[model samples]
Target: MRQNFILQVILSILIVTMPVSAETTIYRFTKIIDGTGEALLARDIAVESGIIKAVGNNLDRSSNGNLVDMGSLIALPGLIDAHTHITYGLPEAPKGNAWGELGATTREQRVAAAKRNALLTLETGVTSVRDLNAGGGIDFELRDAINAGAVRGPRIFTSGPGIHPANDPSPEGTDKTTPEFLKAAAEKRIESGADWIKIFGTTGSADDLTSRAYYSAAAIKAAADVAKAAGKRITVHSYGIEAVDAAITAGVTSLDHPVGLTENHIKAMKAADIIYVPTIDHNRYYAQHSEEYGYDSNVRANLRVFVGRNIETVRRANHAGVTIAMGSDAVLTGFGENTCELRAFIAAGMSNAEAIKSATLNGAMLLGQDNDLGRIKVGYTADFIAVSGDPLTDINAIISGVTAVMKEGVLVVDHRTGGKVNKPNCGTLY
Candidate 1:
């Protein structure tokens, strides 16, 4: 009897400790966009064990799983935000005190606000995000929590604390801003579970809207070398022509917010196969919400000029065949509204299909997740969103028509029948 009891106890322990298998789910869509700029087609996708098992016209119904009939909806691979600050929210600006708003909130309050922001982001069909920076390693904790299913945010690739100049909000805290110090900063981020490293190659919008290179070519290369050796990618926050040129020459994976990129800069980015994420929406948001953010007249005027110039820059880069990826640079007010950047790309002369690819396959390429996360194919992760109408004809449908979202074969947002459905009992989604 004692032996039987021991055997039962051991079996129970094994069952409890083993990873639980995810339920197989079969989703049938009326129209499908594979994220390759392909024409939409009718298809049925079968997902088993959180991976796409098959995708075809008629899949076998023999598999034991939930069959979700997404009626007459246009399906596309889940959207990805190449740049985001998930830990920040729209601050209630006191009179003439934009910076002080952040100081008023406690760490716990900021984290809780971040969680809320993540859920809103997912609801907009953004299944993946690259969180560039957050203070005190909160971004890392948020990423881990989402991955472990402890929270319900997007699949996050984070840089815990970015390497910035002393004038920036989150500086590297190094004694000297040299090549060696920058490399050490990158290494520290890697040791802290950073999937990528972000370096501020130029000044920020709040400081001065110039594209002066903060880090020299040597410094950028040193940081990039360290990240590459560790099998990680590096992106640079650059706005000026000099900074863009230096970042591209240093072999950075992507150059974020290259507002002052020239013809030479575009050519170099193309030659190096470096991605250009012109976060036009970032400036647009600031300009639109200038009064709310307590921006003075000069600050607001700078934003307006930069917005137009940035749009022209994007048009020039796209015309020159530079690879472009959409990043909202969405911080507080633009969390769930990240898709506006895609529309900006369309306005910059890209076709609707091209703009969509910027947010989908191009984003996957930046993260080195092209084979698994960006496309709706056999053996890919089951990450997709459904909309009410075809996005090809009216691209605005991407933002307005999101109906259902599924990540890893599990439904997270269902807005059919005009009622929003978030994940029940899911800490992050709710």
Candidate 2:
């Protein structure tokens, strides 16, 4: 009796600690945009253990898994939002002030906002995001929760909080504005398992669009050096041209929200190979929803003007061979419209294919996830969305037409008839 009891205990322990096996599934689509401007028609993909095992037609015969035939849907690599502050206050609860509305959010509000944004973002077909502006180290907690499956959200590559001065309210707390202090701050973020270091390079946002240099070149360079030493990438948020030169010198991985760039600045960015994330549509969102934030008409008008400037800058940058990536800079009510930045990219002279690449391929490259997250190629993760129309010709097909979303081989959201994942002759395809 004692021997049998001991054997049962050991078996129970083994069962409890055993690794869970992943399912292999086959998904057939009408067409596929492979993220490299190549569209494969009538493609069937085999996903084994959440990774693409094969991609071709007639994969059903050789593949052994659940077959889900997405009928007449155009498949594409999952979209990526290059910039967001998903942890900010809720969109439903608007408390707009002079210019410091974001600073007054409570911890509870911040966490709740993140939770809501996560589901909305996933359903919108964005599989991954680079969450930049956050406070109180909440971004790290949110990222970890998503990775551990405690929360349902897009894959997050976060920079815990940016290095900024005391006056910057988004990141909470005042900091010594010295280079050494900035370097220490970067190390602290790395120790907290932050994926990137961010520098608030300029002072301008919301109704105020000034591009005054917030940090000196030495300070930005110091943080960038620390990030590089820790094998991490760094980015800068410069609302205008004032800090472009310093960002270039710091060798940051990407520059966000710079407008009114001279030809020389564009040339420098191109030569440095720094990616420019022109988030023109974010201004549109802010302006369109200005009433929600208690913004007067003048503030709305200013936002529209900024959007024009942003678009103009992107036109010049894209024409000058500067690599451009799509970033929504989504906050508050902007979560669902995360991919709307693609429309602005098109307006800035990028073709539909080029804009799609910015959100998929370029975004994955920016996150250092090009090998795993951006394409439908074999060996990449099975993260793709089924849209209703051909995104190659019409950009709105992706911007507003994502019908079904699959993340890691799991059908998370399906907007077909009757609110079901399996459509008629689609899911459960024998």
Candidate 3:
């Protein structure tokens, strides 16, 4: 009897540790875009061990697993939002500040904010994101917690804080910024577990400080050096030509908000292979719907310049053979306007396919997860979303919630008329 009880316990552990079977669960769909910049096709996909094992015209699905038959639906690799603030919606900013002057809150409060947005973003088929700004390394902490199964969220690649030029004007009476202070701040962020370093080369007019002052090239270099020594690349936020030059000299890996990327800047970027994450969505969305976000007349007037300048800048970037990735600084005000960035990219003369790539594969590459997450290929993680109509024919289909989801080998959301479904939990482990 004792021997039999021990045998039963061992069998239970094995059953829990191993997948139920080796057979693949097939998802049959009428249209599939394999995420290789290839044309869409009518095909079936096979998933096993949480990875795509096969995808073709006639994939054999003989074994038993849950069969998801999506008829007339268009499927593609999960969308990736290259830039997002998973926590902290756009709160009303005072006249001088652009919502960046929120009171410093506890890390726990910030983590809660991030988790809420992470789940919402995941449901929108953005299976992954690179969070550009957060109060502290709290965003990174959130990512670690989620990956460790302590919290639920989309795959996160985060830059803990927005490092700024020390000389930039701070809020009233604050001590002036110095290179030494800036370097110390950078090191502190790195030590705090930042995945990537984010440097602000210039003080944008959008900040309370009106002057578009840039960090000295030496100062920018210091921040970049610290990031490199810590084994991470630096992402610089710049909206002026001079600042762009400083970023280039500093060897920044990516430039965000290139509101004035000149022809020379473009050449340098391509030469350095530095990617551009032009946040066209913020400009486009704010121009069209500033009122929705509670922007009064004065704020709206200022935003007009932001929109016009960004449009011209994007046009120049596209003409110069520079690589551009999509970034929607889409906040609470611009929640569903993520796809508007795609439309603006298309409007700026980028080919439809190129714009799509910016949001999908290009984003994955930007986050350095190209091998595992970007395309729908054999052995890649199963992260994909489905829409009601063909995205190629109508890019707006991606914007609408035809079937917003993250298929990480398991259904995260099924808004298909049935009641909400919760994340899976243990049920006796058998």
Candidate 4:
């Protein structure tokens, strides 16, 4: 088993190093579900130099290129995880068996752990991610590495760190955090090459489910102004409705993890075009793995109740025509289960098609890459995943059925039979 794992890692290295060529390649699928619609069309996708050249029925074979016939597999645009902490923790077991394992490593170990996470994240078919935070400029560096082709992982758009009182930059004269301090933190993140700014507008997660507001409406608006002036997007994390009004008033690009939103907040968010990233699955993950966090029975029960409230909030939002994006809020044990949030979307009275869109077009729109990343259309980047079942009928087909993956026209992961391939998790992990 050890020898096979070693060989698969070596093979993955070879595949990642493979060069791109101008020669066209064709991938024929049983059915292709473009993110724009509800129908699954049987189509062939042609690629060259990592860009989709053509997508149609029975693509021409006159141009000499490789042709891969994906038997009994359906295709969908590669998924985008709108919220993640990909750099926060390691996928492997901790050196010590406690939640501190999340932050137990040194700088070097953190970097190494992040690299492992990058690969593992790709193994789950997430081609792009909007990482919410990784303090100390680590997320920024990871994004650069992946962009430069030095790392074999998902495309990362990161916020280096969030504007939180827990970190430095508090007001010198008073104990309370001010608008200036928050705005300055946003500027620093933009200066650090963050594509997005994260605002820790509420204090909740892990064992506690309190919905305390971390910033005033003015402070959040000040930070939002900074992000807009710098041409960067911002997302606010609010556990409940405590920070929703402030987030809406600030005009944040998205709001994460908020539940019990009032009718006013919902209407305002839709009016402002603010996307909602519910991230309902992360709490479920913590509740399920209570031992790791030393979460008591009460905490677990609270988490379960929170998930139900979050899903109900989503139902109301969806009914009101507000945009919803899928976000797993993946950390520690949550990397491979990144797409699990789609299940929550389905449970929230969304059809399977709508749930899939939250990960595809909806997520791409939130990331401002709708044209290139969301659909299997001509002239788009060839980033997609193939699964054994059609996601239109069952959301799990997209969540757990990804069998092959391509990023920028490179066949990075293939887990089909005779798939003697890929990483620490390899074929078995999928």
Candidate 5:
């Protein structure tokens, strides 16, 4: 009887002392669509300590964390918008203020807008974004704010001030200074913690009602050099063929527009290994709904030519073996409709897989964050979104319903009702 009592005490002690396995927040999905080129599979992904711990079948639910049973959902890396001016929208300035107003907006107002835009963008499943320009180094502030947990938003990579010549006319208030001044101004932006440099190398047809010719090759090269010296890349905005050629020759890392690119210019971009991000949505939208955007007829007609020509250009570039990254120049109001851009790419003749790559892995590579951001590999950041149908079959599945969104192992937006699970608490881990 005494021996039996001792055995009972020992058993009770053992039961009390044994450690309960840590809850790892296991997300059991009927489908796991890793961003890598590999095919999707059924598996459970585990997250804990704000990192993805494991991914496989029959994951131990209690050993890891809470279980989110995603029945038959398709998952992929969270979307990245390669080029965006989220903090600000197209200005209503009549004309001639493109460079001036951009520079004149107060730092305080710009910072506030950046914060608001960041939150709104995150709710739509944009886990990351690149802010190409801000009037006076305000983007950096927004980036810091997001990082410091003061805001709920996508990770921000920003360009402090888009370097351009002074007093050059445009309605967007873009900076348009000379090359010498551009280099100086770019350096200033870098000092203010710009992630990249934005350079305006050419004038568009209706850019601030300008019929003026684009900037020279030498001038664009000068700006690129300045950005390179600052240990950053320069992405140039060029609507004219001359500007495209100059940007390529000047070693600009990326070209934003190929509006009037010639055959030679296309070959040049391919040879130089430059990435082109043609914002086809704007052109397509303008083509179909010019009156809605209120653009002039001549400008609208010019856009029509540019849009169709660009579709052919993309096909030609693909045939010519040029690298491409996807970006929608259009502002996203919500998640489900964001896939409109991918459909646009398909309409332009790209395969569905190719379009998906342009959005996921290609975008991460463009930001130079591929190591920790893009794919669904074990070590990468746990940034992913899930939908009901197979995105592989229909790229449009991405926007249908972002059933779930995870960033750094935390569930930010759970689309059961098209609402966020909770406002992201960037400062907390638990």
Candidate 6:
């Protein structure tokens, strides 16, 4: 009896440690735009264990797996938004205070709103984003939940809270005026689980439009140093020539808004190999939704001026061979409309293919996720979107042409059949 009991225990242990076979998914597409600026062609993609297993003209369908026929649709890598605010919302006008909106919501309400925003964003074919700011650790918690499969949303790389200098009279616990203090602030963000460090290198917003450097070069460098030591990247919110120069000199990973950038600034950015994320669509959004956001005529005028100037800067940067990444800087209402920036890039003299690269390959490089998320290669993650028309011919297809969205081999949105394939955790918000 004792020998039989020991044998039974050994068998149970072996069974517990055995690896389960991963489900395989096969997707057949009529055309594939691999996000490498290569020519488009029809192809088949096979995914296993959430990673792409094969890509070829004719894949064998004999294996027992889920088969998805994306008939005649243009398949492209999943879109990426390099800059965004996941937990921010614009309050309704007539009763909304732009500044007061930040403090009005409770933490629970903000998290709920973020979940809704994530669903809306995912439906638009954006499978990844870098959220720059959120208060009270909400962004961190949201990111963890998504990674744990407890929530359905895009992959998130977030900076818990942006660091900035205190107002005059220097509020307590908010002193970022010195290099030492800036370094400490960056370390604190890392300790709080921030994937990247964001610094307010210049003043911005409707209240003030002047692009002046708020932090000296030393301070910016100090923060960059800390981020590098911790194996993280740093992005700076900068505008104008002086602030842009300061950020470049400090070796920042990306510069947010360079509306005031001169030719000299562009040259410096190219020399430093810095990435530029011109949030041109953000300015246009405010200009178009002036009344909705409670902006006055002057604010609208300023935004329009900035939009034109920002586009010109982007053209100059592209011509100079500077890496440009797409970032909408979209707030709450702008979630689903984030792809509008891709259209803006085309209007700024970039070819349709180049604009798509900015949203896909270039974006992945900016987030340091190129190894697994950017291109539709054999070893990369199976994150892709399908549109009805050829995006190469018509850039508008990126905005209104998304028919299906697949992230990690799971179909989240399938507009072809008039409904989503796999229902998201939070139901449709729009």
Task: Write down the lDDT of every candidate, Cα atoms only.
Answer: 0.78, 0.80, 0.68, 0.81, 0.65, 0.79
lDDT of 2 at 299: 85
Query: Alpha-carbon error at 143 in model 3, in Å?
Result: 1.1
What is the alpha-carbon lDDT for the whole of candidate 6?
0.79
Cα deviation at 184, candidate 5, in Å, is 1.6
The estimated TM-scores of all candidates read: 0.87, 0.88, 0.81, 0.90, 0.79, 0.88
Stretches of candidate 6 off by over 4 Å are 1-22, 40-42, 61-66, 90-99, 166-175, 420-430
Backbone clash tally (model 1) = 1
Give, for candidate 1, the lowest lDDT window spanning 10 residues: 421-430
lDDT of 5 by residue, 1-430 (tens): 9999899677644433333247566677767766554554446776666566666655663354466777888777787777777656323322433334444656565566566667556654678887776665556767787787777778888886565554234336654445665666667767878888887665652223222335666667776798798788778877545467678889887887565566787788788878877765556544444443456677666666666766766777666756667665543222223345566567667777777777778778778888877677666788887777777787656745566778777777777655543222111100
Q: What is the descending TM-score order?
A: 4, 6, 2, 1, 3, 5
Candidate 3 residues 1-430, lDDT tens each?
9999899677544432333234677677777775555554436667787787666644443345556677677778888888887766533332333244334545565566667767767655677888877765677777888777677677888877677544234557744355565667678778878778887766663323243645567777887888888888788877666578878888887888867676888889989888888886575455455445445667666666666677778788878877778888755434445556777676677876777687788887777778988777767898877677776777666666447464567767666666432221111100
Model 4 lDDT per residue over 74-172, tens place: 888888999988877754664435467766667776787787788777877789999987877788788889888899899999988777777655657
lDDT of 4: 0.81
Find the candidate with the highest TM-score and give its number: 4
How big is the positional error of residue 133 in model 6, measured in Å on the Cα after superposition? 1.2
Between 1 and 3, whose lDDT is larger?
A: 1
Error (Å) of candidate 2 at residue 179 is 2.1
lDDT, residue 115, candidate 1? 88
Better by TM-score, candidate 4 or 2: 4
Instruction: Write down the worst ten-residue block by lDDT for model 4.
Output: 421-430
TM-score of 4: 0.90
